[model samples]
Target chain A: MTGAEGKPAPGKEGAAVSGETETAATEVVAGAGAGAEADARVGVEAGAGAGGQAVAGAGAATGVRDRTAADTGAPDELWARLKAYEGRAATVACAGKDPVNAPMIRHWCEAMGDTNPAYEGPDAVAPPTMLQAWTMGGLSGHEGRTDAYDDLLTLLDEAGCTSVVATDCEQEYLRALRPGDEVVFDAVIESVSERKTTRLGTGYFVTTRMDVRVGADLAGTHRFRILKYAPAARRKPRPGRPRPVVNRDNTGFWEGVARHRLLIQRCTGCGTLRHPWLPGCNECGGLDWDTVEASGEGTVHSYVVMHHPPFPAFDPPYAVGLIELTEGVRMVSNVVGVPYDKVRIGLPVRLEFRRYEGAGTGEDPLVLPVFRATEGGA
Target chain B: MAVTADRPVTAAGAELPPLEIPITRTLIVSGAIASRDYQDVHHDAELARRKGSPDIFMNILTTNGLVGRYITDHFGPRAVLRRVAIRLGAPNYPGDTMVLRGTVEQVDGDTATVRVVGANAIGRHVTGTVTVTVPAGGA
Candidate 1:
């Protein structure tokens, strides 16, 4: 039955069918004017008369299409087609593969260094921030992802907007999730913004809204937006010129730069060696300190790749390692000579001095003690 | 009157009492770690500076939690926050205070929408719409 056009069969014949028909009709009404996309674009642009003009010219389709063809470029057709998919399901139908449980919650807490006791023990609830984690398809994706998302992605791909980056996400949690509660969610293509230019590229901001349900109750909504567009003209990575914060207590460490030595501050009173040049020994609160030449050896205690809010001085995804020196203190420094993802924890590294190009002024060159990965890695 | 979560008691344009929260270094870092966000810009000043930020900044999770707290505190024990959609603008930096302000945007049978904005010294730290299910009685 043409649900969109179906009339209610006199006197409630069937409740389910009528409900389905009405919903389908709503979708059809919402998805109206597929053939009048160009005119609608003009209407949106003109903010008034153009859409009325197009609506008036509905019978004069050929004439309007010719004028649109002669006026704007052809990309609007694809944009309009993409817009037609709005309000449609992004995922087919999905459920959390596993119910929310404590073990996963504990692991997430541990990874996040979260000491919040609310997420533990009996009567505990998952962190609201983990709303999306419970819905992830993991290394293997789930069954609910629809073709529209993939098709839209492919369209962007064919248009040379191959690289996709998550711009940002907004999540709303309406209910607390308890362990053993199953999650079900449905995603919709909410809106597609007009093509816009950004530092990254010229692309459309595609937003998908997901309504997460706990049983039949509405629990939350997650709206995620991403840009699907061609890469913009690239800018050169900023040449390193960042000034190291030099101040009391750490000035000696910079002075060691002049001597081509990496100095670790050793508390004279307690003999605790610190790489960061802390003022006092934590063990004894001893302010008296002297230099100990670093043996230039350490292991990667932890590391991260700086990805967002790109900087001029450095490109993103570069590894910054927290190296645990054999001398018993940790120093944060850039890890060079290895791929960023390859810079793993427990990776052995040796300290090396590298002088950055002189900052615009012929001031003393900014020399730094960077760690070079030693042989052997995970 | 103790406004329990079950009392549906609010009207459109009702303003929630403003909350002034301190943004500390520990708040930013611990919040980041709590949210499982290990981005260096959120904790390491040296790294943050190298990345162009003057100092470390707050993570989105902390902002989310703070926003959640703001609404729950107002609605009381029975209100269930059904949705919290927020977008960040200014960074919540340490040594600054973020003041949260909210206006109830809409009130239906048992639900209310609160528009919230958190502002720090520099400017708007975060802004978003929160939809919550109040107890019966049109809060």
Candidate 2:
């Protein structure tokens, strides 16, 4: 059962015992030096050997691992895993029929904080963003090929890709999901191309489409950009420097900064508060607002240290904050004065208006709320 | 096909007049993924046949997007999609055309109500209404 010399042995019970004995016998027959010397191709990286090298490694340990992990020798196991999702497979069919489904209208209503009976009411209906919620729910389980993008990834992985990462997702919603309605999904592979090499490895960029339906009616489509990685050597991080602040927009908030009191608005109808001074409340359809002063203290709901600069005005390793304010509203701002490694969830933060320069010339003072690490809580 | 403007639309009024726009591939695809829908009926011809459908069916998500897009296009780019209520009446198969038609039903200072109808090659595919906020002067 021992595979040939250079091949990797798969991790399976049936093959392990027999393969070990044969492997010992082969070592004796080929001789220690003869095995490596006889197989000159053995020195190049383990996986990418030539046909001759492959034959030599056929019974070897390396061969088995690769074969088993790939869809070669362990077809039954892979097939079993894939079949587990037969019921939950991604499709362009109506969603309502699948009663136990994720991202249904009920789930969306909860996520968007819509409490009105209108969505479920006999006469009233749901909002258009419901589609966005459904899509996010579908993509939550990013591992399977029940959808087009997942199918494409499965195919690429079968074709010998090492790793895959989702780069971007853009969705344009057409309508909202209504009660008693079934949603269908359509998917297609848009394009694939070899992208530039990165620190991780050389990779390819793949794009795919998923079209939705509700029983013969057109819904919306989602375009997904995915990155597939190839093997590469690792690199070290460069010397650290202070991350720069991103403060371009927010002139209006900064103008209010001169007033000395922090001001925010609440919808007159629904009592929902909003920051950045919106004309109306997204909830309750109310236009008039009541101003309130925030305690300027909030918790960091989620944040990331962006290593790559999306725009020229920003630099690497800058902390971007999504803070849930004391007023129960969430806003995206900079988490200033904190070290790169210190940002984490539930970290207490305070607000202070700071000036940020525009990309071109003059610096514009913007009111930015920066978060710092709390002293007591773990 | 070109059609005459149905009626004049005022920005700051109770409600802007309804508009009808044909469904395009872009909007169709957007709705599909926005809803995370992936089925043969929505995109695959052979699969649709296997599933007892005439052809690839239009997705509910895509319908929602189109209806919202149609209203927003008429209202102005700044209008956000607040809510839409519709019941599917008939199937909207590929190659069949559909229209997004709506009318201003009510107006309260900042919010206005619009009733809309989605008709296809058959007749009415979906009928419902939406409430959206327009800038004070459509500015």
Candidate 3:
């Protein structure tokens, strides 16, 4: 879902006809630099070679292999060659396989469970995140993809880094896309990180920046990053529980937990209590809020024992309760000090902190808050 | 601009009723296809397993769409989603049920920011915030 626009669809050729003019414009741009034209031509030939096609000319094949041999001879040389591709076009003026239209938008909404009227009816705009979606080539692949990107990947492949995984993508929306708007985008190889070893393997991170346009108007910018790695040896079983997603909005809560305090948010404007900390007070529409430490008291408002589709870091059949704190705010956490079946509604429980040691996997030691059932409760 | 008289009074701390979404193979495959994501890990079980995933998983676009829907569904059709920022956690595999819950975090005039989280049996699937504007007169 990241990196360049389309994944290479095997055996699909001759899709580049519509992008001929765009490709020509790219060559003109590449012509600005000395020898860039030849580099671009070599890139195309390398792309064809990587696609399982015999090089159109015997001389071209030898030229590609010679460069590959020279580059792969040294790790630093391979990296330098890869870095040289930075700032080159990954795709030039690639038109979206489909125009921003209703049916696709409707299908997307239905699948996402979205029913926003803004995405429907006569005056509708596509979801902003669908910026990359419109540019995808689906199973048939897309046109306008340049050989430079394929050439880069082929270099990595020859170096024994074959697997690829999308790491993340960030998008900025400038204009809302309406139905019937033609989508065209140009992508650049923005950056290539030095080889780094990760839990998955040793790999290089390639980041591409795409500018999506509607006609002449810039609509959005999407930056996608991927890791092209040589698969590491079999991974050790993941240790410990999945780390809780702690962001700025809820960092304070986690910080409080480290200090053995269970804090709840109180609206400054209307004094309403809220849990699972939020930035604003919903009742009084107040941006200002403060936290109050819970009194280490609560009852199980509801409970569920997880038994199936077991998750890592958790033993199955454990009770996860919606603990309603005495302060009138409820939060979910484990209910300990009792058998899973023994956890019942209205059971009195007190706040407790549990510590988990990091397993040397780049994870930090974690302190999480759990609730313990009090003696003779319910 | 719509008048404010008909709009329901929105306040901080208000919780949107939770919705349960069934994670089915059809939903996962169709969602990926609808979003034009041809990643085999999203629609092909065999390929997904080869890729180290237990099964085909939901793509980020679908996750974003669902988050947008969860907000507009509560705020009324007049709600305009200004932004949806989310990070995925547990993979949403088939047969699992993801429950989406939201809390209105802040309301400034007609615009309200809600913190949303979608969780399945494993744990949290997605968490983020959504900014939406509802016309004063609710649709």
Model 3 lDDT, full chain set? 0.65
Task: Mark the regions of model 1 whose C-alpha exceeds 4 Å error after superposition.
Answer: A1-89, A102-130, A137-148, A154-176, A198-201, A214-218, A229-378, B1-12, B20-62, B91-98, B107-111, B136-139
Clashing pairs in 1: A112-B33, A172-B84, A174-B81, A174-B82, A238-A312, B5-B78, B8-B139, B9-B139, B10-B139
Model 2 over residues A1-378: C-alpha lDDT tens digits?
011111111231011011000011100100000011111110101111101111111321110011111212322332234333222323233232332133454454332223334344454444554543343334233222234335544544553333432332334446545665565443344444423233223334444445555656555544443334333332223323233332533344444555645667777888888876777678887887777777788888999888864544566688788988887888787777677667778778887765544433333434344555554323
Q: Write the per-residue lDDT of candidate 1 for residues B1-139, one digit (tens) a residue.
A: 1334444648999998898888889877766554444545566777655433457776555676677667766676556667776655456678989999999999987789999988777667667778877677543
Q: Is the docking of candidate 3 incorrect, acceptable, medium or high quality?
A: incorrect
| Isolated chain B TM-score per model | 0.91, 0.76, 0.92
Using DockQ as the yardstick, the better of models 1 and 2 is 1
Give the candidate order by descending DockQ. Answer: 1, 3, 2
* Cα interface RMSD of each candidate: 15.2, 25.1, 14.4
Local accuracy of candidate 3 as per-residue lDDT tens digits, A1-378:
122443322331111112111121111110000010011110100101111111122121110111111122234556678877777678888888878999999888777766566787898888776777887766677656778877887787776566554433445567889999998887777666655443334445566667788877888766655545554554445577778899999998888988988888888889998987888988878988888989989999999999997887778999999999998989999999999989999999999999987765877888888999996443
RMSD of each: 17.3, 26.4, 22.7
Index of the highest-lDDT prediction: 3
Error of 2 at A52 (Å): 68
Residue A271, candidate 1: how far off, in angstroms? 58
Model 3 native-contact share: 0.21
